[model samples]
Target: MEILRLDSFSFRYPHTQRCALKDITLSADEGDFVLLCGASGSGKSTLLENLKPELRRNGERTGEITCLGRPLQSLSRMESACDIGFVMQNLEAQLVADTVRGELCFGLESLGFPPEVIRRRVAEMASYFGLGKLLNRSVNTLSGGEKQLVSLASVLSLSPKLLLLDEPASQLDPVAARELFSMLARINSELGITILLAEHHTEELFTLCSKAVLLHNGQVSFCGAPREAARFITQNRTLSSDAIPPQTKESGSAYVFTSLLPSAAKIFPDEPSLPLSVREGRALFKQKISGRTPPAPMPVIPPTAPPAVSVTDVYFGYGSKDTLLFHDLSLTLYEGELSAVMGANGSGKSTLLKLLCGLLKPKRGTIELFGKRGAKPTLGYLPQNPRLLFLADTVQQDLTACAENLRLLHPEERIQSLSEALGISDILSSHPYDISAGELQRAALAKVLLSSPRLLLLDEPTKALDPFAKSKLAALLRGLVQSGVTVLFASHDTEFCASYCDRCALLFDGQTAATGAPAQFFGGNVFYSTAAARIAAGFSYDSVTCGEVRNLWIK
Candidate 1:
């Protein structure tokens, strides 16, 4: 049975000149796992919102939309809200309740579900998604990943017939992300839920989704199998995969772990498709090494200068709760380094970053920058959300303002060089929000580049990029490394960490479990690589980049 159908559906913003979704015709049958992918602003959100008609405003709409046999346009707000569960792109904005329990129960209470029923459902969902422990926790206290998961659980508790998810796992760590997807798959398989997820991470999504739809510029460019859409996007690099009909790549076999890479342990998988992520690669490698000989890798640390970034005797937390985010934690980052901090939700990976970037003061101990310790630890910082830009009316104005700010202090630089390099030269005059997320990320990068800092601290940098955009970022990071910049990035993309990073640090229980190369860290231990890496299966002299792995073949 077709759970929902859209026929010749078209819509535009209020009084807008152009259509936001033009001739958008698509359908999702009952119990189908559908992946809706497109570039930023490629009608993905528009279409998802249209799935629940009550969300749409006074926009010009035509054609027929039926949801569970009801006319979509005529459905009441309450009915539609109950029928469709939406987990939006910006989780922060959608969150309404003050506490975790309140947020989860708010909707159920409104629907007049028995308080006992709501409580029971809330408990089930909380435990199911690991939120049971944080029931009384304040919503704002949760990290990006926790908030997202909580929001998702809140929606899923409704048992919606159609679930609309826009990058639900975008801000989680690799372990958390894998767990989320695993849960999603389990729910889809068990609950007869129809899921339409718009995402940027294709590697894992491809394995999970049964069908794929690529949208570009408010139109459906292609709708088919995951492999077909992957090929289409790969071949076409000129257009954003989600926005325009993408050209599939002819020969590149890279996955997109833009900011991460794993170790090249001497364990290889005897499988069909080699893994492209650390977790997947390591799993396969583990299988191969089992009942067989394990190859030893040479210790990667060199007998040279001291570690690049070192934290000693650090104790930190917020208010007086004694959260003890980091308890006397000490670590070292060697020179010419690309290191990552990995942990589950609320493990203080980000808090540690804030201390390193000089944004927060440590409750105890000291942090060293390149060889010195102080309040002014010179480092470049890119927050998870790039919301620091001044409210300039136009994109050109934003750039000019950024350049001007950098100029007033340094007075010895040029904008054309960095702007061109970052590919933001063309869109220098558009509104910041009007631009795509990828472009906004790039522009933010360019702005940070202007400061010419020696060290870079990035928090979940690949939140919303598709595979191609992610790969481009990985290449750019590699370039920065070659240019002698050190990076301390936090990412949920395990492949990114396993492939590009020289070392991996796993933060757990207010302390780091291990800190070493990807191979050493992921090999023969509780720590794991990504699914792509596992699928790649087996060890090569070098593991492929976390984002991409090509077969060692000429075909």
Candidate 2:
């Protein structure tokens, strides 16, 4: 039975001329795991929000929406709240309670559940999601992944029949993300709940989803089975090459939507059938590389430049009474290189960046910049939450203020260039909060780059960026590195680190566990590696990115 359907749905936000979603016709059956995908600002979030009446944006909407065999707009508040559950991309925004247990009980209590019933539900959720130790922990103290899990459990505690998720794994590490997806699969398969998820990370989800929907410029571009959708996108990209913008054509693929395809699908776009899993990709790779000699491994050259930022035996924590997050952690970042600091959630990656930027002083040991202890150098720091960087109402206002405050010459010219380069020129007039997460990330980055700092520090820089935007960011960072700026960023995106960063440092047990070039770092990793690296592992090539795999095949 069809649990939900949208017929000719079109919506436009207030004060906006263009529609956010246009003529969107879609449906989801009971127990169906539907994957919704597209580039940044492609109406994915807008559509998801509209589906949940309580969270829907104030917009000019025209359409027929049916839920559980009734018009969606006519559903009572109680029916809407208990039957449909929504999880937002920003975990902090959805969580309101102080503790994990409180969060799980918030919804049930609001709905007038008895204390005994709430206790049983909360207990079940805690045990099922392994929240036993964290039940009483403060939500603010939890890591990003932990917060995400808590948010999901809180929503599930209400026992909704349908779940709407927006980039649920955007903030999680690879292993955590896989586990979250596995749990979501179980929720759909075993419990018979319907799930509609909007995400850019489709590698693991494509094979699990029963159906796929692709949106472009506020319209439904493709809707079909996951495999057929991949084939359609590949064919469309080839046939419409001339229609692609000149700027994006050089990126190899025309449409940013194609970047949402699985790595194997991207590597073999012309194949009769695209591979969606590592097992399938390895088989295809073996068949293609049969009787071919493997290429020599790339040489690893250590940087000779002086240390831009050095941390020696640093110890830090939130308070004197709190447990130390970093215990004698030491690391070095050389000048004129882009380095990535990666570790599991709550492993002090963000805390380390704060110490380098002087936002938080180390409790023990020392941090030095350019050989000087406590010397405040010109630096740029982008925190994990990009929303914190915006002070002005509009994006343009924020960026202009940043430039003027820095006393930069030709402020308008610099702003124009950066905005255009970041692909946020169109949203300059809009409020920073009004843009999509990916767009907001670029806007924050624009503000940081306007300063022209000698050293750059970023935490989770690629948190919400699409693949095309990621490529652009990689190129932009490469240009900055060539011009003598040093960069150190902490991230959970192993794929981006493997593909673009100069070095990969893994933090474990409150210290640098291993640090090396991408080939040597991710090449040795099993669960922490990229799909391309795992697929090419059979040939012993140590290729860690799709581009490397493609180049190897061409040679």
TM-score of each: 0.80, 0.95
For model 2, the local distance difference test gives 0.87
lDDT of 1 by residue, 71-132 (tens): 88677777777779998877887789999999999889988899899989999999888887
Worst lDDT window (10 residues) for model 2? 238-247
Error of 1 at 75 (Å): 1.6
lDDT of 2 by residue, 312-378 (tens): 9998877774788898999988888999999998898988888888889988999999999999988
Q: For each of the candidates, give the backbone clash count.
A: 56, 0
Q: Which stretches in model 2 have alpha-carbon errors above 4 Å?
A: 238-254
Pairs in clash, predicted candidate 2: none
Q: What TM-score does candidate 1 reach? A: 0.80
